[model samples]
Target: MVFYIIGAIILVGVIAYVAVNHIPKKLHWILSIILLATAGYLLFLINNSIMEPLRFNTEKQIRYTEVIKKLKVIRDAQVAHKTVTGDYTKSGEDLIKFIDTAEFAITQTRNVLVKQKRGLITVDIEKRVVDTIGHEPVRAMFAGKDYKNMLKIASNNNIKFIFSVDEIQKFGNLTEPVFEVKVDKKIVLTGLTDYLIRQELEAATGDEVRGEFISVGSLNEVSENGNWPPYYDKADKNLNKK
Candidate 1:
């Protein structure tokens, strides 16, 4: 609508200029050129302001599709494991632990292993060094207990509290007092998983990973772009792929 209005205004101005020039025969050619240029500049402004974000959204959609594809691959692998084990049941954390072990193996060879991460609020308990880092939401083992102070007190006692991913799996309840451990080098450990868990967080959350898609995207993008592309693969042309 605005574009049409602007174009109509320019057309009116041009017609007026022509009529006045014929009557007065005094209008300069430079003034006509200036008016034409001003109209063109307005069009350029509209394109940059209105059209660029649309382009950006197109790029975002493409990147999101790729994320979903990779996530599906990871999910298929997890389903395969469950099929073999005859356990159609496992909590999100157990699946992550399984993948964590596998990720560890891949890193030993210094290979690029992609995984998805999802944030969930859970209590972590170990020997008492419970601080939550990574994408997971951290909370206190006891409802009335202050998790921060608990961790601080535990650390002072030289007790290493393990983040309670394991206990949560066993007890089948996040409400059970679980110790949170800040896994060192989360970037590294997150990618590592045992043989039992094939694809790290990808298997753990599946599409639920959608919640933290932005953060996972940020980390992966940084890693892929900040470092050289994989030796066997081409560099990603999509700037938003991370």
Candidate 2:
């Protein structure tokens, strides 16, 4: 509504100028030149206001694209870390190891405090817990497709990762009884986290999936108890079956 009012005012002003342009025949050339220059200047100002925002958006989009690209590296590293350490999650240090310079163009800033968690993985935007896409082959799903914005792919697809500052914590410290990861204190799986776990479970099972997560706070609980799941050696069995 405001925009419409502003546009209407501009239109009215233009029409008024055109009407007045016809009144003075003796100074018509000077009047025409002044009107044209005024119009051009207005257009330049409008263009700067409009295009500057668009250019900023484009630059931000590019940066987010780089983030998603580096996220692939983080995901792959998490998978490998799980394979060796028997933990499906990655710590803050693990993520730093995975992130390259192209992602943020600087060494990662570490913040163990809860408030800083949102800023850890996120460069310019707020942290978002991405939807779980499971372990589907990216080549089969998203390889050839062009994503105009990284948020679409991260929000809609099978990328089983959370963009959080807690991911920057050291792995060994994650399960310490006297310590806690910033985001894991509640032992509650958010809608997004539950969704991610479910995707992972379904992929491990090689069966039809009904939901997204399996054990909601198993790790946080286990950490408190100072014991690993008895099924650690049988994670495949645990993750596969209902």
Candidate 3:
């Protein structure tokens, strides 16, 4: 639309400049002024149309990066929970409590060779042995973490992220556990301009995005996958692959 308007303005400017040469001096001045005003309005429209998407995408990148960070934290916490409980939990409160108060056994193992003496000969055999070395608290595992802020969206503190876990029956009637953490795009993109939000939704819908929620893990399967593009990983080398 902006391009079309600018093209029309230029065409009109050319025609007006040519026609004004045959008009009286006062009429020429009026027509030139009108053309300049139209050109100024077209410039404003051009700038607006060009800048709006750039601004939207910039803010989207910033907000999505923070959202991915939070999702990674959630993924780590869920993985730890599963490590201790054999399955993930659906409650953020329970997850936070587990993070704060759980303990996991740390085992020490060593490979040893057993030697047996029989009269004047010795036979050596290799074996593995395991021992309970110690236990470490989950909080210690995640020391220096800000537990209070883990479940909230960064842009809008009021909106807590959504987390869920489920058990699904896989092949041969075997069951497996899966977990998912999610936040609404609107929640993460809060404080952005309304125009940007609408554009985001429209683009998402056009692309057939599954939900308004950006998420990691699968509720329908036993996969710990995230809903991010390949380019996202390419862009952020330090991003956790949990």
Candidate 4:
């Protein structure tokens, strides 16, 4: 693109000089060739400038969809792990093992009225109790999902998501289970244009991924949400696959 720009400037100066001076008939063909070549270069540049972004955006959605699909799986797996153990795991292998072997305790909760007396004042109080009714395999919850490769990234087969688990303080110093699984945007968008990747890395818009990493969960908060926009959630959330 830069080469075309430089050649275009030189061609414009030559055309300007030719317009102001007398030219011989022998030079007509040379001028015509230069003009046509310059026009072609300019057209190529214009078309490329227009198409690069379109191609980048197209590939972006495709690769992002693929990676986000796996990310959603990891997120759901982590949620199930937390549900069974009351905490998240940092090890991807442990997460997968838990998904394959864990059991979900089916429980039922109900409210009952109890009589309480406080200093000769008897009143009815509501009490809530929970009971373990049954048990179900955790694997049953992830039916129709991708097995084994749940931790693998779709765009790049060799690359896996960076997984971590920790606790975050909630209201009034209460800590809750938190886990984060992420991969760099550059890795996900590999072999693409560099400048566009830089622009994506600096993305701060709410509709975009909003950071350098396409991640799920947060170490700073207790959210199971991915950093992607709701457009992905519409598909991944409704797909019925963990």
Candidate 5:
């Protein structure tokens, strides 16, 4: 809008200047036509320059929103995998299979009376005297029905998101395991226009960064946090308003 306004002001100023100079009556029509054409072209450039970034910003927000959702699903699956297997899987294929077929042990504990050496004592024990009472399918933990689709990014169907698990040392003695799920932004914004893609990458990293992936959790540290910026929350809040 500001671009349009500025272009209009410049256009009007040029026409006013041409009219005030009044070189010749015959030349007025030619000058006015040329000025109008120039103004139209300038407006086109201005509108494209301003609107392209806005369009790219919006597209990026949407893509990231979906990417974030998928990343969360991966996180949940990883957590569930860790819970049942005592370790995270590095393969995306294995993760998806686990989500589709694996079941987690469900156990319950309660206080019960026990015979002690001196007297009767109350003790907390598993409901069935076993660690697991029953099992729940991993799919039950997530709302989405299709585990395969969840493994891929929403934008570019050709590319599958990456997942990896590694061990990191803590306290210089103990080693802890961590997993990271990632999807490249280039693949996420693949179908977008060239200009929009360029704008999105520039805005995201402030440079011509390649192979930038949005991810959750960390392979280098014992953390299950995401790498997205806080502005994602703001963008989601604004979207919810609409």
Candidate 6:
């Protein structure tokens, strides 16, 4: 928009100057051709300046959508693993295999009378006992979803997601299991304009996908949510609505 305004001002100034100076008739066509070329160049700049960012944003959303979908799949699979094994798995192949062949142990809990030792005293106490009654296939929970490629990044095949697991202290007493699966923004935004990618990297707000990674879960915390803005999820829902 600014470029259009500036171009218009410069063009008007050139035309006024030419008419005031009264250039030769032979030179009039030359000036006209030059003006026409200048106008065409300005239009090109206007188009490019307006369209380049749009193009960048469009591609960014496309890549982010696919990446978020895969990240969600990974997160669910990890959650299922933790439910069954009491901890998250770091290996993608192991997670897939577990999902394919493992069964969830369905159990029932009942109160039973048992002897408990407390402070050198033995007393009869009612305790809860859980018994496995049946089994449900783990694969059944992941029906119609893709887990085999949960480790692979959908946007860029050259770089897969990097995941790790650890234990963190919560409330300075409880040790909780933690995991994080992440990919560098550069890898996800590969082939994009360097300056724009740098801008995104430097961003530090929730308004955009700010930071060095487009990741889910956390090694420092126990969250299973992605770091992207809510609009990404809304965008996915909107696309599905269509």
What is the clash count for each candidate, in the order shown?
32, 9, 0, 0, 0, 0
| lDDT agreement with native, every candidate | 0.35, 0.38, 0.76, 0.85, 0.74, 0.84
- lDDT at residue 151 of model 6 (Cα atoms): 70
Question: What's the TM for model 2?
Answer: 0.31
TM-score of each: 0.29, 0.31, 0.73, 0.85, 0.71, 0.81
Maximum-TM-score candidate? 4
Q: Where is model 4 more than 4 Å wrong at Cα?
A: 15-23, 110-128, 171-173, 237-242
For all predictions, the C-alpha RMSD in Å is 21.5, 23.4, 6.2, 3.5, 6.4, 4.0
Q: Give lDDT tens digits, candidate 4, residues 114-171.
A: 9999998999999999999999999898888885788776558866689888877777
lDDT per residue (tens digit) for residues 1-242 in model 2: 23644664586477558757665666667766766766776666667656755564454334334333434344444444443444544354543443221121122343342333354563343444434333432223233323223222332343333332122334766542111222121122223234333433344343321123212222333322111223332533665585
Off by over 4 Å in 2: 1-30, 45-57, 94-242
How well does candidate 5 match the true structure in TM-score terms? 0.71
Q: What is the C-alpha lDDT profile of model 1 across 169-228, one tens digit per residue?
A: 333553221221221222222322232122322433433222212221111111111111
User: Over 4 Å off in model 5, which ranges?
Assistant: 1-25, 110-130, 191-211, 230-242
Off by over 4 Å in 1: 1-27, 82-242
Judge candidate 3 against the unseen true structure and give its global Cα lDDT, from 0 to 1: 0.76
Most lDDT-accurate candidate: 4
Error of 3 at 76 (Å): 0.4
List model 5 lDDT by residue over 174-236, tens digit each: 888899888777777887677666655565554222237788898777888787777655754
| Model 6 steric clash pairs | none
In candidate 3, position 141 carries an lDDT of: 68
Model 3 lDDT per residue over 138-228, tens place: 8886766566577766466766778777888888988899988887777667776786676666554332223577788998877676776
- The sequence of per-residue lDDT tens digits that candidate 6 reaches over residues 78-181 is 99899899999888788889998888999999999998889989999998999999999998988878888777775578767888999998887889999998
